[model samples]
Target chain A: MATMPASPAAPSSDERLARTGPATRIMRRPEFGAAIGAIVVFVLFALVDSTGKFASLDGIARWTDSAATIGIVAVAVALLMIGGEFDLSAGVMIGTTGLVLGLLVTEVGLGIWPAILLTFVFAAAVGAMNGWLVVKTRLPSFIVTLATFFSLQGINLGVTKLITGTVRVAGIDRGAGFDSARAVFATDLWEPYRFRIAVIWWIAFTVIATWLLTRTQFGNWIFAVGGDANAARNSGVPVHRTKIFLFMGTAMSAALVGIMTALRLRSVQAGQGVGQEFTFIIAAVVGGCLLTGGFGSAIGATVGASIIGMAFIGIAFAGWNTDWSFLFLGLILFMAVMVNTLISRRASAGATK
Target chain B: MTTLSEAPVPTGEKILELKDVSKSFGSVIALRDISLHVEAGSVTCVLGDNGAGKSTLIKTLSGVHEPSTGTYEVLRKPVRLSSPRDALALGIATVYQDLATVPLMSVWRNFFLGSEPTTGFGPLRRLDVKKAKQIARDELLRMGIDIRDVDQPVGTLSGGERQAVAIARAVYFGAKVLILDEPTSALGVKQSGVVLKYIVQAKERGVAVIFITHNPHHAYLVGDRFFLLNRGRMMENWTRDEVDLDSLVKAMAGGAELEALAHELESLGGAAASAAEEVADVVSHPTRGEDTR
Candidate 1:
């Protein structure tokens, strides 16, 4: 018998190995692709702006208002993505929540504060139900949430017409506490440009979400559960609870956006926010959230939302045919995902070497 | 080089003992009358071929499955484990091949995955990123694993490095009985050597290492005792002194069974017969075959 010699690749001075440079480190970030995409799109829109105001403070306000609403939900959707799930009902959830608030104020004769609070509760309950069905049935969240999306679409239209005798609910401005609710959710800031309060909310929410994803224990569990559910379970991570909470978060964010829209307009149509689910998911994917889950950043989702918002406002300002907007979006999504995959592959390989 | 003519004796305390353990999955008996005890600071190799109940034995030991009939004692105290977490609490960690680490996550995150150490108080408490990174780096280095960066995803690491990370994690988390399910089965020769070195290092750290592998050469390299399993039964158990490399290989290769298979192949004649004869030749003269040992 021969005694085995120790492994030759035993710990040597790793200092002799190449250290990762700042550029490589930055490139390896999950949000790197989104950040680059955002810059390029911003430049493209600024160059093509026919009104020239597309690069001004007024233009910033207009695009930010658009981005803020999408950003809020996209961030939460990004979190859900990182936790390995999807919420297709998120867009329709806004309509469900808006209609719920509309009825509570205009029909139920409740104050704006009470109606807004009740709408949040309704949305949270629905979100929890979406989560419960996903976890219990072990069905793809796509199928389960799609079921929810269709069900809520029917409810939003059917219930609104049933109660108001019209597909749209109005006259919410007359409800008690309407002024304070509007100031908080839909009020504008700045003297001339008038930035929407939702912009502030978006920034604040992004900060909170970023912190939750990077600094906390729940954040780690999110990555683990998304990356490998079995490994997470084996490591004693609470996979079910994390996923359910992620669903609740996306729903609640939708409610916040819904309430903001309702208060700002003082009315809501039953079909409001119908197809916005794709926009939210598109923003997340563009922002560097993997469609398969287990990787993303809140800031990346925010940047992704900004890209969509810019595209919407910028295309109209550029006097181009707005009909081609979706085509542009498809191209951006493809390019962003391609860039992200390529960079991540290169970065991982480089770091290992 | 250390002396190889004589077998090494394990003189440490018995840390884990399984007495007449048997596990059944409804109608199918996975493990039967499996009795083995592991000593602290020693490597116990469980050698078997495919479908030889090695995975069942690892699962039973790691608390993933409970024995239908047997007593499992840890440090002389009989305990029934409800889950892997329970086993973890008792310092028994099982590292499963391909299921050990989250591939996309950073090395530091995978290191402190389930039981992350947090700083601050109340809701303000967060993962101690700085401290976690430092400790993960130190722990891997301690185990002779020089990772390029703690922030790199585990998927970038070679197969052997991933196993080393899992082993380091188990060791850091106070795993008394380390159950590695075929840690080297998926690795190349050099990579297998890397893992085998860690097994010895883990044993040197006074860990009761349970190294599972199909390769007898790997077992002979570090194992202080050997348990051969066949069809869920403990076919043989031997101390290092009672076994030699040649007999160990012949026994694992199924001494008489290989001869029977070679003869059966020879009946095909021509090229098949010549190939079978060569195989028979190697089987008859084991030293003339691959110097895997």
Candidate 2:
């Protein structure tokens, strides 16, 4: 038998490694570009604000309120993207779930809490259906969820108009347990500034999603399935199950935002969340999620949402045409992705050297 | 450290045996009348060119495909395998050329990809990141892989280092019989040497290694016993003492086929034919250092 090396040899010439410094290491993270982008956008808006309130605590509350709803769903969409799937149905799922909540409370005469519970069950069923179809049919999730998007869009308008004789549902404030439900989902916290409770929910979801991605077995599976599905399956990872659950997660988070929006407005519109799916995807991509899959961060998605939120409020405060906002967002996406790609290339190259 | 078994199993114990194996896909025969045995602390090299039934043999051994007629045995007891997982459960692990690793993932994460260890209770449980990283670093070091950082992505590693990672992973996961498919085919001269070193390291640790390669030089360097496969048949089987490098190369190249090619070239050309004849002579009478590259 061969003896163990008598002592750990000095760093050999053949495998001499050049370890990274703190700055390079930090820049190597998948979310670093998004983090930097968030700061730059904040500073640029702060410099150009015409309405002095745009830089105040009240403005912070207003912009974060806009970001929170998008951030909530964006976090889950980020997870689904990392697991290598897309849910085009996420945006329409909001309208569908809100209509369900509004109908259950106003027409079915159920308590606000029970109606909310039934809405979640409905959302889960749709999510599960999206997941099952993607796994069993082996079709691209983009195609399957796109079909779901169109179907749900039709159902949102058709079912709401058929029952309520209008394109919207109202009188949610008169339903049983309205006071308690509003306190949980729609209440404004803190005096003077009156920050919305949804911001806290958004922050909490971000924390949980980050923990799930970084510190859990499920998180590892997400990265694995996204990185290389064949390698993962050969290594005994449950590829299909992980992917299905990611689809379900995106659907369910959309439902949460739907319920919150319905509660805050005390009404639901058929087209309330229509066309918002692209917004969630934009937030995720700007946050450094790869369209191809396997590499991203949840906090990055949150940062991306905040950047959008700032742009929306900042543009209005600067008295610029709101139409220019989309152009600015497109530019932001391109720049964030470019910086992320370059930094990642350098990080990997430096590590090997 | 917790899973490392320092005491090697006694040598010369036959760990795996395939008896009278023949596999046919529909009407086409892929492998016919094949038999081989692997022992503890030894390397069995299976040498074949492309489409020489090497993949079929590997599949049959690793349970990706079942032999049409054979008794596959492990530890002298016949066992039927239905899937790759079944083979893995029985301590038979196959590392393909790609090495079954996600390149973008960190080394520690890829090391514990499928079977991650978690610590804590109920919903509060989490991946034991510190333990996984430590064990991954230690196990790789034990295999002489000496990776400085377990956090580096697997893509940053060289081809040979990735092979070492895969080998080390299989060993740490309690593989008794490791099947390596062309581990050196994509590597350079130095990288091939590195992978060959790890194969020897694995053999010395008492793991039965079945190395499948197309290169005779690589096979002859570390192989204890050699099996030559040609056209879905076992043409020759010899122990290290019974064969030398030149004969091994000659058998693999089919000496008659080379001679015929040399003759064919002579009739077709003048300068090129002379060059071809000279090349054939060097191949037929290979010098030790001259042919290794």
Going through the candidates in order, their DockQ values are: 0.44, 0.43
Docking class of 1: acceptable
* lDDT tens digits, residue span A88-109, model 1: 9999998889889989998889
For model 2, residues B1-293, the per-residue Cα lDDT tens digits are 11113344467788889898999999999999998999888999999988899999999999999889988988788888898888888888899889478888899999998899899979989999999999999999898878888997887788888888889998888888899999999987777777888899899888999999988888988999999998898988899999998888877767667777887887889897997788678667866325443
* Consecutive 10-residue window with the lowest summed lDDT within model 1 chain B: B1-10
TM-score of model 1 relative to the true fold? 0.93
Residue-by-residue lDDT tens digits, candidate 1, B42-107: 999999888889998998888888889999887777888878878887788989888999988999
**Candidate 2 per-residue C-alpha lDDT over A143-189 given as tens digits, one digit per residue, 9 for 90 to 100:** 99999999999988999999999999999998889999999999999
Q: How high is the TM-score of chain B in model 2?
A: 0.90
Candidates in order, TM-scores: namely 0.93, 0.92
Q: Any runs in candidate 2 off by more than 4 Å, and if so which? A: A1-15, A350-353, B1-9, B260-283, B286-293
Q: What is the C-alpha RMSD of each candidate to the true structure, in Å?
A: 4.8, 3.6
Question: How big is the RMSD of model 1?
Answer: 4.8
